[model samples]
Target: MAAFIIRRLLQSVLVLGFMSLLVFVGVYAIGNPVDILISPQADQADMARAIAALGLDQPLWQQYLIFLKQALSGDLGRSFAYSIPAIQLILERIPATLELALTATGIAVLLGIPLGLWAGLAPDSWPGKLIMTGSILGFSLPTFWVGLMLIMLFAVELGWLPSGGRGPTTELFGIPVSFLSWEGIRHLILPAVNLALFKLALIIRLARAGTREALLQDYVKFARAKGLSEARVVCVHVAKNIMIPIVTVIGLEFGSVIAFAVVTESIFAWPGMGKLLIDSINVLDRPVIVAYLMVIVSLFILINLAVDIIYSLLDPRVRIGEAKT
Candidate 1:
């Protein structure tokens, strides 16, 4: 396990190094920030000062080298727009995004797995068909349109929930969270539900497929033949085997939820990293853009690493020593 982890860490470093180059170059090529950042009314002296201050005066390769050096020391530099360290800015918004992503994923797993198991256990039943139909619709619908419909129905028409915003939060271990208060939960529901639809649908399908496959296995039949209770047979024998793949998907998808919550955040006006990223992109805030991408890349790597470890533990066949090579 130690050698496996070491090998994976080495691979992750290489991936991050390559990705940093690609992300830096891509952001650089996306039109200069100076044109928008510096007013046309500014004098040459002012322009020169601004350019030099932003380090845009340096060559591209030199700028990247400097960024690489600063990044190594955990200094991702100041945002051209926010006038603050980009990493600090991103971290400030992380709690909101993390809360949102976790809530959404929780909804997916809690509801989806049971429904999927039921459907897989009895595909011809009315309730099973209904669940399957709902999953299909969840898969088919576009996120933006669903978000709009939800806002209109819940916030505008029914007045049951707040349309947007994170409402209120209290600190837990110095991190602000909405799930602590009832009012905060009311505010979280619409957007969290909106964000969860697609993921929930995916989990449902995966769980259903895995359950069906697990039911056909010899172990399941053996369990039944051994006079094990049906619930124990299904829940313990079947569910455990099914969860191996689902856990992996859920881990990776959690990272994606964090990275791509921009649409949901934008629609709901949620104060999260996704919204910050969109704002940064509008003015070509290169530091924030690059910093955000790098942070996301790091998160993906970390999540992947955690998932790999979990996968190995869950399934003994995934040989750690053999995979290290």
Candidate 2:
């Protein structure tokens, strides 16, 4: 296990190094942020001074080297727009994004698993058909459109919830969270559901497929022949076996949910990293952009690593395979 973890960490370091290089080059290639930062009235001398101040006047290779050095030392540079450490700004908004993503994922798993299990057990039945049909809409619908519709129905028409914003939150362990307050939960419901829709659909489909497969295995028949309760056969034997794939999908998708939340955050005016990323992009805030990219890339790698570890734990075959390798 220690060897496996060390190997994964080393792989993560290599991935991050390559990702950083690409992000650094790609960010500059998009456009010079200094162009937008400089006043139109500024002359050649002013432009030269601005360029020098930003180290833009340096060679690209040299700039990259400097960036790498700073990154290794935990300095992602200061945000051009906010004039604060880029990572610090991102960290400040981390709680909101985490809260939203976790809430969405939790809802997806809680609802999807049972629906999927039911659908899988009787794929030809009316109830199973209904679950699949609803899942289709969940998968097909656009997040932004869903968010807008939710706002229109719940906030505007019904007047049961606020349209946007992270409403009144109370600190839990020094982190402001919506789940702790009724006011916050009302505000959270729409966006969290909106963000969860796709993931929910995906989980339902994956779970159904896994369950169907697990039901056919010899152990399931053996359990039944042994006169174990139907619930025990399904829940303990079938559910545990089916969870391997579902776990992988959920782990991977969780990272995606956090990284690709820009649209949902924008629609709901949710003050999370997604919203912050949008604002940074509009003005070409390179420091913030680079920091966000690095953080996201690192998160993805780490999540996959965790999933791999879980895979090894859940299935002895995985550990055996790794040992052989």
Candidate 3:
């Protein structure tokens, strides 16, 4: 298990390096750095200083090496637009985005699993057919449109919740709180539901398919023949077996939840890395853009590693050479 983990970690490092190179090349290919310095008014001395400041005077290979070294050390350079350390800016925004993603994922899993189990158990029933049909439509709907509908129904029409932002502007229990408080949970409802709707649909379908397959297996039949109660057979024998594939799907979807939350954040005015990345891109803020990209790539690799470890624990057969056990 240790060796497997180490091997995966090494592979992730290589992948990140390749990703960084691709981002660097893509950004540089878009325009020359000198153009950014002399667009409005051309001044020879100013141009020379700007070129030196940005390391444009250095060889391309040397500049890339410097960037790599600084990035590895967590420098991430200063934001060309913000005039602040890029890493610091991203770090400040991390909590809000992480909170939103985590909240949405929890809602998705809680709602999706039970619906899936019911649909699978009663595949021919009206409730089951309805659930399946609804899930398909939910999965096919665009996220931005879903967010808009939620805003209209919950915020504008109903007036049951705030239109946008994280929370009410107030304090609780003598403590100052922003949109991140318990009162703020109401604000999170629309955005979280919007973000989770698609994932919930996918998870429900996957879970239903997995449970149906497990129910058809020989072990399930044997459990029934052994005089076990139907509920016990389904819960202990069938559910356990179905978990392997469900775990895989859940992990992949959870990773995607974080990756795709950017658009949802934008629509709902939620402060997160996704919105920050989009804003940075619009301004052509290279430092912020590169920093955000690195953070996202790192997260993707980390989530996959976590999934692999969870898989090993859930199924011993997945452990390296563990089939011999």
Candidate 4:
């Protein structure tokens, strides 16, 4: 386990480096932020001052070297748009993104699994057909459109929930989060649901497929012949076996939820890193954009590493395969 972890960590370091360089070069090619930052009426002296102040006067290589140096000591530079440390700004918003993503993922798993199990167990039944139909809508609908519909129904016409914003948050473990407060939860419901829909669909489909496959296996037949309770045969033998794969996918999808959340956050006006990242991109806030991308890349690496470790623990074959390699 130790060797595997160490090996993965080393690989993560290399991947992070390559991704950072790619991000930096791509962001730099998006045209100079100076053009957008500088005023049209500004004189040459003013332009020079701005350029020098931003260290844009230096060669690209030099600028990157400087950035690389600062990054080693945990400085990702300051946001040109906000005049705040990019990393600090990302840190401030991490809680909200994490909270939203987790909530969305939870809703997906909680609702999707049972629905999927039903559909798999009775694929031709009416209720199962209804559930599968809904899953299709979840997969087919665009996130922004769904978010708008949700807001219109829940907040506009019905007026039960707030249309946007994080609302009032109570601090939990020194981080102000909405899930702790009732009003906050009301505010959370729409966006979380909007974000969750696609994942929920995916989970439902995946779970259903897994369940059907598991049910066909000899163990399920054996459990049935042994006269075990139907619930035990389904839950223990079938459902239990499918859970490992479902969980592994869910774990990986959590990172995706965070990455693709920009549209939902924007539509809902939710204050999360995704929203922040959008704002940074609009202004070409290079530091913030770079920082956000790096942070996201790091998150994906960490999540993947965690999923690998957890999967190995749950399935001994994975560990054995690695040892053989």
Give TM per candidate.
Answer: 0.97, 0.97, 0.90, 0.97
Q: Candidate 4: give the clashing pairs.
A: none
Ten-residue region with minimum lDDT total, candidate 4: 316-325
Tens-place lDDT digits, model 3, residues 151-203 = 89988999998877776534445433344566788877888888888888987
Local error of candidate 2 at residue 8 (angstroms): 1.0
Question: In candidate 1, how many Å is residue 275 off?
Answer: 0.4
Residue ranges of candidate 4 with Cα displaced over 4 Å? 320-325
Off by over 4 Å in 1: 319-325
Better of 1 and 4 by lDDT: 1
Cα-based RMSD of the predictions, in order? Answer: 1.9, 1.6, 3.1, 1.6
| Model 2 poorest ten-residue lDDT run | 316-325
Question: For each candidate, what is the lDDT?
Answer: 0.93, 0.92, 0.80, 0.91
TM-score: model 1 vs. ground truth: 0.97
Best by lDDT: 1
Per-residue CA lDDT of model 2 for 129-208, tens digit only, reads 99999999999998989999999999999999999999988999898899898899998999999999999999999889
Residue 288 displacement (Å), model 1? 0.6
Among residues 3 or more apart in sequence or in different chains, the pairs in candidate 1 whose N, CA or C atoms overlap within 3 Å are: none
